[model samples]
Target: MSDERRLDVLRAIVQDYVSTSEPVGSKALLERHHLGVSAATVRNDMAALEDEGLIAAPHTSAGRIPTDAGYRLFVDKLSQIKPLTRAERSAIETFLSQSVDLDDVVTRTVRLLSSLTGQVAVMQYPSLNAATVRHVELVSLAADRLMLVVILSTGQVEQRILELGSPTHLDDEAAVAQLRSRVNELSVGRRRAEAAVALVAAVAELEAPPGDAQGQSRAAVLRAVAGVLAEQREDRVVLAGTANLARSSNDFPLTLSPVLQALEEHVVLLRLLASMDGESRESVAVRIGAENPISDLASTSVVTASYTAGGVAGLGVLGPTRMNYPSTMAAVRAVARYVTEILNQ
Candidate 1:
């Protein structure tokens, strides 16, 4: 068989194996596809592929299966990512647009991704380290009670309430409005860490008339809130569709136990997803079989892409090596693109 025909045969084998979860035979290829070749010629090509370690025979008399190397070649050389349908796009937009807060948006996104790919979905929470302060909202509920909310450029919102050492500087709306203006002036447009430091310094220097306990209380509350926001630059990860692993448990040669345990380790997954760095957020990275760092994931494939600009965070999915790469890659790319747009809004 010619080189073109052999590659075509290889592609056909991978497709059939993924769809049916069974070994594919040369006769099956000819019977199912118009390869324009006799059974004997196809068997010869299969032998050549086996010699190259791309395909393997699991039984002495049965058909062939694609090896990890075979899957890699198929993904890199033969496949084009299938584009999302219009209905899929509309569903994503509708589900994400209804989010009322940052937490809600992330929860919905992870769940939506799982449903789309039919595999385990993972997302890294937006990194506060990449965020800049947009504004600081301060409210005095009572004499000693203060509520503080910090808004970030990435549309993430964090809030905290404080009990001051004494009465607040403002019990009236006019005075509270003035404090908000001053806080924004000190913090808005600055990096989150830098803004926190500046806000604390500005509040500390507040001048108070003699014996002004309320001014002291205000300074203390602002300082506490600033410190909290600065320390809140935590990076967390969210995962969904873990139960999907159980559905295809038979795919794993030994058992899915190790893979399940690895998925439960949030830190391990964060590092695994971040392993595909240095590429633009628009591109998808696929790691097959032993290509993954954790050996437990050796039986799996990971497809990843950064969600927002500058790759502030990442999102991806995990499935057996027999996964449908074209469709999975398309789903990941589309989800990441939509997530970026939503956060930007």
Candidate 2:
């Protein structure tokens, strides 16, 4: 009768469908929920919801399922995410607090989300091009080989190795010292890719040959920056809880396969997270089924929250279309907040 009663019915139907993975019928809704109405009245409400495109019934005798619009309404207006319990809060705090390095922090964060939610979890380390360099070190490994370590403001560490076309006349210790000074002189506090491109072009301009004064210095810098950016181009993308998808046998081929394929593409996931930029890190974003631009992901749903280290970088997570939005959103938002705090510390 009233919009309120219809909304209550919609919520009940969605919760029932999500748990049962089946269409919801009016008789079932009336039998299970204390909706204070007859089955006929409930059926009328379902029809209205269907007309509004919030719920759908697949067969003549079947019950209803919430459409994307329905879930969006639920997440945007009706859903109340239960807060993390004290135990969960303490455990997340403990796990994240243990990490003193960026790699450790992200690894633990992915595991934490997977364990807590039992869903496929994706965490994106910030784009290498967006980060400011904290420091760069050149360590000589051999007469003709050297290792370049690049540290970013987010505590991310990347190392690259460069082999000289021919051994330089300088001693290993002296060459390393000179290389570090030269690379950092140009790269520290700059973008690795941007600086690397510039440094490479700079080296390609030297008037002297490879072993000459201007040429040798420029070549060393070139090798170091190139190594670091090349390493970052093949970045890390950690995924867990894939077995959880196996439990869904109802529409396995149609629903799960595409999502799994999309997950394997690091570039796709990165682009998805990157496209959701401009939203504040604390805000929760909803991408409905089929709204995902990736055709493989069209049947899946994704909710993303950008986790940031103040001004340094941001990380994100992607899960299923039928996700427990309230709980998952809360878990993701809380973890992102705590992780940012840890990185800031």
Candidate 3:
């Protein structure tokens, strides 16, 4: 069989199987797709595809289904990612634009992706380690207590309260203002690591005289601020649409218990997302069945893309391997782009 004709036959089979969730025979292929070839030619192409391990007969059925390898080839070389419709684009923009905070953005995004693809959606919180310091505020709660609020470029806010051992000069308005100004001067516009280093150096420079409690208190506050920035390096993930998995339970040959167990393990999902980072926002990574590192996910597929939100993070959907590749890829890429835009704005 000619290579183009053979690939056309394989594409037809894959499309048919994805739509009907059943094995595809030559007669169905001819009936559905105008291959412009004889039935004998189609049968020969199916035989060659089966011989090449691209298609297989599950059970004793005469029809054929695409293997994992076949799916990989279809995605990598044959499939054209479908563009999102105008309604989809408008829905994404309107839904994501209404988000009031980082938490809300992630929540709405997960829900949107799940709704778009009818699969479980996962997203990583933007990494604070990669975000620059936008501002810092020091509020005096008492003579020896202050609330430190650290704001990041990604719109995340962290607060820490510090209690000095003894009553200090923090109550003096001018002294408190001076210390807050100096901390911001040294830390603002730098990343977490860079801000921590700058704050530490400032602390070292604030060595006090014998009874200069003002300098001592100032130095202690700087040290505490540095500690807060240094300790926020952990990344978090959010998920939605787990019930969608139950809706497609038949897609999994085994029980759905293992898949649910894997999803419950956030560390596993985090590691998987971290490993699947794409080269850019436009690059959508697809890990088909058996290609996923997690054994529980071996029968599933993950479609992910990286987005920048003051930092790089991942978002994607997980579903059975028999998913519609073009539509899923389009939704994942479009949502990721819109998210990046909203965040950067």
Candidate 4:
């Protein structure tokens, strides 16, 4: 059989099985697709494909289903990712543009992706480590208490409250203002690591005597602000549409328990998201069936794209391997681009 004809047959089988959740047979392929070939020729092509392990017969059924290798070939051979319709583009913009903060953007993105792809959507919070310190505020709550607010360029806010050992100069309004000004001077416009180092050095420069309460309080506030900057370096993920998985329970023949458990364990999802960092932000990465590292996800597929230029964060959808790759890839890519645009703004 000609390789082109055989590939066309494989493509037909994959499309048919994915849509109908049923094995594809030679007769159905001829009826559904225009192959311009005889039934006998089509049968021969199917046999060849089966021999190549690209298609397989499940149980006693005469029909064939594409194997993981076949799906991989189909994905790799795709000429173009299907473009989102005007309505899809408008919906994405309308929904995401209304976001009020970083949390809202991530939350709305998860919902939008889930609604678009009919699969579980996962997104990583943009890496604050890459975000420059936009501003810092110190609010004096009491004679011995203060609130440190660290704002990042990514629109994320980190706040920590400090309780000094005793009443100190922070209790005076002018003293608090001076310290806030100094903190911003040292940390503003720098990345988290640089800001932390600067804040720590500022604290070390304090010449407070061992028994000096005011100097000690100022150093404590600076150290606490540095700690807040350091703490946000860890990555986090948000998930939505887990109910979509249960709705497609038939897709997971065994049970949805394992899949649900894996999703709850954010580490598994984070590792999967991180693994796609090598791909460019403009490219979509698809891991099908057994290609996933987690055994529990062996029956599933993950479609992901980096939403940041540095590829430090990403968003994706998870569904059965029988998913519609073209549309899903398009949605993931579209949403990722929109997210990147928002982050850039």
Candidate 5:
């Protein structure tokens, strides 16, 4: 038989194994698929496929199952990503459109992906570098204390409170207006490097010909701005669907828990996403069992792709090895596309 026919039989075996969670035999392959081959011919093809290390028989009496290599070939060569059904699309749309806050959107996104795929879902919240400052307000709380409230386009709010060395005793209204103007001039849409320079320049421009008391207060405010912006490197990772792993056919202790453990570590998770690097936004990467160096992640497979907004790209989803690759990939791609749209909006 041809190589294409051999791969076809291999794909058939993987599908059967994934669905039934059983070892697939040649007789079963021929019976279930119209490969136009007899059982003996199918057995010969299975043997050849085994020699190539794509599929293996578990024991002398048992049937065959695809190896990690087999799964990779199936994903890279055979499986066509299944598009979301209209019902599934509608469900996702309704779930996301109802979110009122960033926390709600992320929480609902995790739950939605899990329910749809029956696998653990991992989502990285939008990074600060990609978000523009929507507004900044200064609220005075004490004789020498002020609170800086920062609102971003991504719907996250951050506050930095400054306690001056001594009270400036300026009119509250005037001080707030000056501070707001200073903040807007300094820390807008520019990322860290540009923002830091802008901040230093803004503070310098506001410093001179001012009282020593007010200078101390302004210095405190600038220090507060520096501190908050220093934490820009911190990124958020949101996880859900871990409970769904209990439903996977893979043996729990041997397969699931380690994968779960790996998912729990931000460094490991970030490393996993890093392994899938590329500039092509349209490509979908499939890392099958054993392809990931983390032994705990070996039994698991991950399908990852990147999404961009405001020229910044972030990854979405770390799915299972036995994942319905076709549908899950489609879901990731579609969601990434829509998420970019939403972010742009």
Candidate 6:
């Protein structure tokens, strides 16, 4: 048999089984598809595919179903992810554009992906490690108190309220404005890692006119700016459509309870996304059953794509091994692209 014909049979079996949840036979494959082969010819091809371990006969008289290896091949080698229809694209823009902030975008993305794919959705919060300083704002509330806000290109906001060591020194509005300007100048284009170090030197070089008051004021204001910009960032993820998992509860041989447990653990989901981050944006990362390192998720398949707005993050779907790879991949890719566009905006 030709390799092309054999793969065609495997594709037909996978599609039929995925749709009907029933073992596929030569007769049904011929009936539903234009394979241009006789029933006997298809049956012979099925036997060849089964021998290759790509498709398996579930029972003595049953037709064949794609094994995990089969599904993986079908996803990696045979499938062309269907493109989203015009209506689907419009829905994505409408749903995501309603977001008010970074948190809102990530939150709505999970819901949108889950609804689109009919599976659990996972969206990793954008990594701020590569983020550049976007803006810095300072507000003085009291002689000794001021609020410093640090905004990053990734849309992460950090605030540090400073109780000035010498309140009277930083009390002047002009001093605060000068300090804010210097901080933004030094930190705005620098990466998060470089901002803290650069801001400190910029403060020290400030040419304050001689006097205890002016000197003390410069020192106090600069200290507040540096303090607020220096801090560690933690990576986070948001998930939605977990209830969708319950719909496929019976699909798990051991039970979906463990899968649900895995979702609740953020570390588990983060690591899962990290594993998939290496793939280029043009192709979706698909981790099939047993391919997942987590034993609880061994029965599930994860499809993810890394997104870059300010930095690299991840978004994808989690579904049963029997998922419709083509359509699900399309939904994930479309949503991840829209999310990246939204983040960059």
Candidate 6 segments exceeding 4 Å error: 206-211
Could you tell me how far off, in angstroms, the CA of residue 79 lies in candidate 1 after the best superposition? 5.5
lDDT of 6: 0.84
State the lDDT of candidate 3 residue by residue for 233-277, as single tens digits. Answer: 778899999999988898898898888899999889989988898
| Best candidate according to TM-score | 3
Q: Which candidate is the best by lDDT?
A: 3
Error of 5 at 291 (Å): 1.0
- lDDT for residue 30 in candidate 5, whole number 0-100: 76
TM-score of each: 0.92, 0.80, 0.95, 0.91, 0.88, 0.93
Give a tens-digit lDDT track for model 6, residues 170-261: 56788778777877888897877688778677666664666667666666676656665566667888888989878877668778888989
Give candidate 4 misplaced runs (Cα > 4 Å): 128-131, 170-175, 208-217, 232-234, 280-282, 309-311
Q: For each candidate, what is the lDDT?
A: 0.84, 0.72, 0.89, 0.87, 0.71, 0.84
Worst 10 residues of 4 by lDDT: 305-314
For model 5 the TM-score comes to: 0.88
Clashes of 5: 2
Q: What residue pairs are clashing in model 5?
A: 82-326, 301-321
RMSD of 4: 2.4
Off by over 4 Å in 5: 78-80, 129-132, 168-175, 210-220, 249-257, 277-280, 309-320
Q: What's the C-alpha lDDT at position 13 in model 3? A: 92
Model 6, position 325, has a per-residue lDDT of 92
Q: What is the C-alpha local distance difference test score of candidate 3?
A: 0.89
- Expressed as tens digits, the lDDT of each residue in 1-345 for candidate 4 is 787888899899999998998999999999999999999999999999989889998868779888888899999989999899999899899899999988999999999999999999999987777878888999998877888788888778778787765675677789899999999999888888889899899887875898887788888888877877876567789999999987788877699888888999998888888887666355999998999889988889999998762236889999988888999999999999998888668
**Which is the winner by lDDT between candidate 5 and candidate 6?**
6
lDDT agreement of model 5 with the native: 0.71
